[model samples]
Target: MTRRRRTACILAALGAGVAITQTACGGGTPSAAPSTSYDATVRADSPALYLSLGAGGPKKQKQSAVALKATYHHAPGVTSMPNGDRASLFDGTSQYVEIPDDDRLSVTTTGELTVEAWIRPDALTFAKTDGAGYVNWLGKVSSEEARTEWLARMYSRDNSEARANRISGYVFNEGGGLGAGSYFEDRVRPGEWIHYALVINTREKSDAYPTGYVKVYKNGVLRDQDALDGYDIVPSNTDAPMRIGTAAAKSYFKGAIGKVAVYDSEVPESRLAAHCRAMHGTPREAAGT
Candidate 1:
């Protein structure tokens, strides 16, 4: 209404405009604030590589841990087998080649990682119920018989029939505060080849509400993804051999397995796709439904 008031109002509006522009350019007040950003990136080429094992590749057993190999042949640390076929599981009716110790694989990691393996489970073997039998950090246990393992699965444990045709991942920690983890089936489908992967986050401790986890992918789709909790801290330098098919039970896998790999880090989806593409056979359409 007055000349002075109109002049003051114009100055105020101009000042506000300047302040907003300054803030947008990150030059306003010197407030202590955290900032972040996101970017859309299209990678033309990736430098990452996948770890591969099994069938016609360099052998792991012949190089180190020969004694562990003996365990598979009904012998531990002893290299002699009467059968000319190196080693075989003879269950009276039939005999199939068990996974070789050289090929008995595992990866030692404490940060983050993705592990993929091709398994051909023998018929009639039921996987652990808690899905803890196969993929888990073997913790300190009175014996391998009573170890607490971690796992991931699609169906609810309460569902009576969920375990029937479901695929699951497992982690078991036992002995001296250290542990081992793995992946397995709720029900056994013998003579059929299956591809499985375990993804774990090691940075998050189990107590902090489980930042790490394991996921089971059958074929190409995810079947189960589970968090790691209710377990003790993973022991440092736990270099226990990565045993497939069976764990601690001498419950070895009976059948043909190829392209086994243990990676030092969790694998990404792109890397997983590349891995699946390199291997033989089509990825099964997500296990079960």
Candidate 2:
């Protein structure tokens, strides 16, 4: 089937809120749980952090069903999704969510990690001192000193060689200057709700590289990937806490952010796709895969 047709089918299934099952990459078939029930089912499979920006206002949003139950320091403003669900809106200048640093949220040199989010940006570019630039969707960095440990953000169209509105994933080791970081890239459009995921498999070594293999997915499909090899994307004990809608004071995202999840283990390709389907209001069985 064509990409357009496949996307249409997935959206249709999501709209119906149908629950379906599909086989995970490793083994047995796993059920595609609805977004509402995701915390219970998916979280049970592995330790994770789940944040649902639902009908309530930003101040009312809370971490759901996770062991740590991290709290969020949200800025003002609210927006509605296509489904009429409320989401937190960030205005490049100050709107963002700050989650305190936690050991569980940190990435290591030899473990799997996954970060996923649902976002819809008002504009791809935001104002900066030099020129217009993109913003970060989610990040974890140190505030003491300007250091980015790990983050998923849109590349600065005015400052980088990357294509306009491209999404990039970054990782840096502790005490390793920003130059010691590695990144992967993909593209995204503004004003549309999209599911973005970053999967890092540290257990598997790449033939051509030394670090972990990384994959970036959009709408449940892999779009870009690379190996961390020389760059250190993992964080040490001193790294900063994870934040949503911004990375420290800069790169504040200008958009409405919905569900954000962080998994300690790499999410299987099938399950990741199912989660994306659920976010769009469709059931996996209806995807016709």
Candidate 3:
């Protein structure tokens, strides 16, 4: 080949290298998740952390919107997402991601917090991740004894066939480990994509929901509410790293996880529901998978 032609080809290859992975440059998939209508809404509110984990299966996606990167484990599979996007696939055994601890995660005082994720749990039966047989998916609890902050997880069939694959949102106190949790099972369809959310407001105290309260959502709709009896939050435990697809390194989630965001403030019900709607532009369907 001519010298000029060879030089041009090398430059062309280097230009495509901007993607997080080599596959993004050659594979048919695009390098990022498409923008959604709610992107503006989330951007306006400015969440403390937001991760678009499906940037063509990159080990890390630049957190341009919120400035947070994720470290993947065991090379989870990248699968085609329902909304014309891509997501990280967990083997239901040992794949997850971990983000370093940051001060912004420590939302204290009237511990207002909102955690959201778009997940498609596969049809396979997940094994026990914790003693309770629940696979913790996301949150701030570093370990079983590390400033137990909060985590979002799914129930394994080992706990109860009836409650298997259900979604639960739990929060705990920092030093001690007292906790409160709420769950929703109607949304557990082994093979479909659903937007899930957990909202907590600790402004007021209630005997039933003593430490505060938590609400679980499916496809942006409220499914259940429960108390977070962790004797008031111990702050957002800085020592505890922000984790996804697993909690306390005990429970690991299987299936696809994408489009994760964390806000240190309580989000309104209406807006929370809108987030799910904005993600998928299709007609509304029933909850069951």
| Candidate that would win on TM-score | 3
| Candidate 3 displacement at residue 183 in angstroms | 0.8
Query: Backbone clashes per model, in order?
Result: 41, 6, 0
Q: Which residues of candidate 2, in runs, are more than 4 Å off? A: 1-47, 55-74, 82-84, 128-132, 144-147, 156-162, 176-188, 232-234, 282-289
Stronger candidate by TM-score (1 vs 3): 3
Alpha carbon lDDT of each predicted model: 0.35, 0.60, 0.65
Write the residue-wise lDDT of candidate 3 on 142-228 in tens digits: 575557677787877656556766788877767536566778776355656767888877775677766668888766567788765
Model 3: residues with Cα > 4 Å off, grouped in runs: 1-38, 56-58, 160-162, 175-178, 204-211, 230-236, 282-289
Sort by lDDT, top down from the best: 3, 2, 1
Candidate 2: Cα lDDT at 105: 72
Query: What tens-digit string does per-residue lDDT give for candidate 1 at 261-280?
Result: 44445656654544443232
Candidate 2 local accuracy as lDDT? Answer: 0.60
lDDT (C-alpha) at residue 13 in model 1: 31
Candidate 3 local distance difference test against the native: 0.65
Worst 10 residues of 1 by lDDT: 33-42
**TM-score of each prediction:** 0.47, 0.74, 0.75
In terms of TM-score, how similar is model 2 to the real structure? 0.74
Candidate 1 off by > 4 Å: 1-109, 125-162, 174-189, 204-210, 230-236, 281-289
